[model samples]
Target: MSKILIIEDDLSIGEMMTMYLYEEGYEVKRAENGTQGEQIFQTFIPDVVVLDIMLPDIDGMKLCSIFRTGSTVPILMVSAKSEVTDRVRGLQTGADDYLCKPFSMREFAARIQALLRRSQSFPTPVHETPAGHPIRLDFEKRCLYVNNKVVETTFSEFEIMRLFWQNEGRVYSREELLNKVRGFDTYVTERAIDVHIANLRKKIEADPKDPKHIKTVWGVGYKFLPDPSLS
Candidate 1:
């Protein structure tokens, strides 16, 4: 089973998310604040994290930065702040995706599902983003889809996606992914993957501000989180 940790100061919101996640069949854990959240992150090592930016202690962006230095666990950032810079800052700080306040529970579920699907590549060949509907990967054509339409993608990102689609739910540390995507012959650094992911998000996601798929696993690496229910 996939583990998910919720780090939010709002008890009501945290509990609500926990309930939804449990219903969705994820192993869910909760923390009231940043410190407690970090503790859970250390002890539980969840596959995905739902983090609120406006915590009472230790702001979410800074915490995200700290987490990014080490692990690559998928992080979904929730915040009341809807500013463009705020979202971009969160991404720059290493958050995989950001959600603004007052969101629909149904879309929330879909977003989480998309993030999970993006994290783990599997037989389910297509994925979704907030801006566009679904991104279908064509292994034979080396092409991607936005709904039914095709989108241009770089070769490097395509290679990464192929690897991710094959690995699915398994965690691929930076070194591991580099070796796999770049190949031993290419001698590519993990940072290369980072650059590629950033660019890929720009191309595939309709609203990069709130990405529906492709998330960051702070401190460790990135993942293609697929919806666990589909598994």
Candidate 2:
């Protein structure tokens, strides 16, 4: 019963997407333009947004960027523009995935399924000790705990974090991560990487803005710099 929002200018296309998602058993909401889209987001709070770049008011890029300022809800940009730069721009603007227009319904369906799968995954964290304290990552328990509380993480996020946790101080490029993060290697626009990293930042770091653990490289990639003093 996941809720999804579709912000598209084309009525036919919007309805088409809505029909398909509905058939797939997802609750769908539609917005004709960016302005209306934002309003709907405030009220409905969708699990994901299928946003189009070109809109009547306040372009999708601007809207998505604004949405990222507060929520980490996954965004998938669907547009007719097939340019790599456009895709990169969408990702840079905080989109989690991108799909070119005229795409088949089957592929679109698969993408939604994949995104949902990744979004809902939560691993049993690795604990630091048998006492079940929430202050450490217990390798045996496979859970993360902070302040005697369990730290939630997705399956992929946990693996990426574990690598950094073990290494302590090391950088991993997007390419390296594509291989490490599984079949995600095929989708190399960096949107998925950015989103996953964004998710990790929210889950593990004390302050996602000034992250002390996961640091971003200006033109390269991301690194793990855990405080040596931490438990």
Candidate 3:
């Protein structure tokens, strides 16, 4: 059974979600505050997290970043704020998905399902770049190695790299990249993709200022060049 950790301050809502998720055959745990949530997260090691933005102690955004530092466990941020900026910030902070307040339990369940599916389907055999290439991708391990050095990457960054690597030389618009990375159900602005790409280049490119692997196609979008010499 998939484990789900719900970090919600609202007791009624938290209990409601827990009950529904249990009915869905998931092992569920709830934390009333961010501090407790963090503790449970370390021990429970849930498959997915349901986090509310308005926590009594640590806020959801900060908690999300903290979780990103060590694990790529999918996080679904729930917030009463429906502003575009809030949603973008949540995604940029490493959340896999976001749900605004006043949401249906059914929709909530569906969002969780999508995140779980995406996480579970990510692993495969290691993929090595052409001989002498500086980059290596271990899909099963979800680790990126550049010049034989392991590079730390956020979940979004890794997903973007995975897609670009699989379809090298294919240009993808910011919107297309957003949909491909975060799923069609998410509605974040395209600009978030730019931020993720920029962060990714910093880790993989010799110089993020003039990226060699991910190149901008003026008037269109961005494409990955497996062979940096071609850039």
Candidate 4:
């Protein structure tokens, strides 16, 4: 079973989220403050974290940066600040996804489910690539490394990178990638796939704007070019 940690200062909101998550059969841990939340995070080592931006200590953004420095576990940030800058700042701080306050429990649950599904979805191993960049994908550990340094990625980004690594030269359309990576009935749009690819490129490519690994096919789709010299 997947474990979830909720770090919310408000007791009522924390309890409500706990109740709903419990109903979904997830192992839930609640922390009312940042100090306690950080402690629980070390011990519980949850699969996902539901973080509130307004915390008693160590605000969500700081906590997110701390977490990002060590692990790749998915983080869903929740706050009353719904402005574009708030969302962008949360993402920049390393939160995988952000949800404004008063969010529907249904959408919250769906986001959690999708994140968990993507994190657990890994394909069989493929042949090795010729030496080039110092990028490495460890299928056994489900980790990515750039120049031997750990690289953090969201669940969807990881899935997309794994697919591209496995296929190497095969081109994948947005619809095809959605079906292959997220599966059907997931409610993810083609544009979401583009977003995932974009995020993955930022982490994997030497230059995201001029991606060497994930190349856009313009009118067709996207393909992974393993050989840096070829393309």
Q: What TM-score does each of the candidates earn? A: 0.56, 0.67, 0.90, 0.80
Model 3 ranges off by over 4 Å: none
lDDT of each residue in 1-231, candidate 4, tens digit only: 999999999989899999999999999999999999999999999999999999987889999888887787888889999887787677667676778889889988987887777777655564344566667787766678777777877655667778888778888989888777655443324655666777778887889999887899987789988676776
| Model 2 residue 166 lDDT score | 65
CA-lDDT, candidates in order: 0.70, 0.74, 0.87, 0.80
Evaluated at residue 173, the lDDT of candidate 2 is: 82
Model 3 scores worst on lDDT over the 10 consecutive residues at: 182-191
- How many clashes would you count in candidate 2? 13
Q: Which digits, one per residue and each the tens of the lDDT, describe model 1 over residues 9-109? A: 88788888899889988899999989999998999998888889999999998888677556656677888898876876665566656678787766666
Model 1 weakest lDDT span, ten residues long = 181-190
Residues 131-175, candidate 2: write the lDDT tens digits: 532236655455566666666553445556666676666778887
Best by lDDT: 3
How big is the positional error of residue 43 in model 3, measured in Å on the Cα after superposition?
1.2
Poorest stretch of ten by lDDT in candidate 4: 182-191
Q: Comparing candidate 2 with candidate 3, which one achieves the higher lDDT?
A: 3
Worst 10-residue lDDT window, candidate 2: 126-135
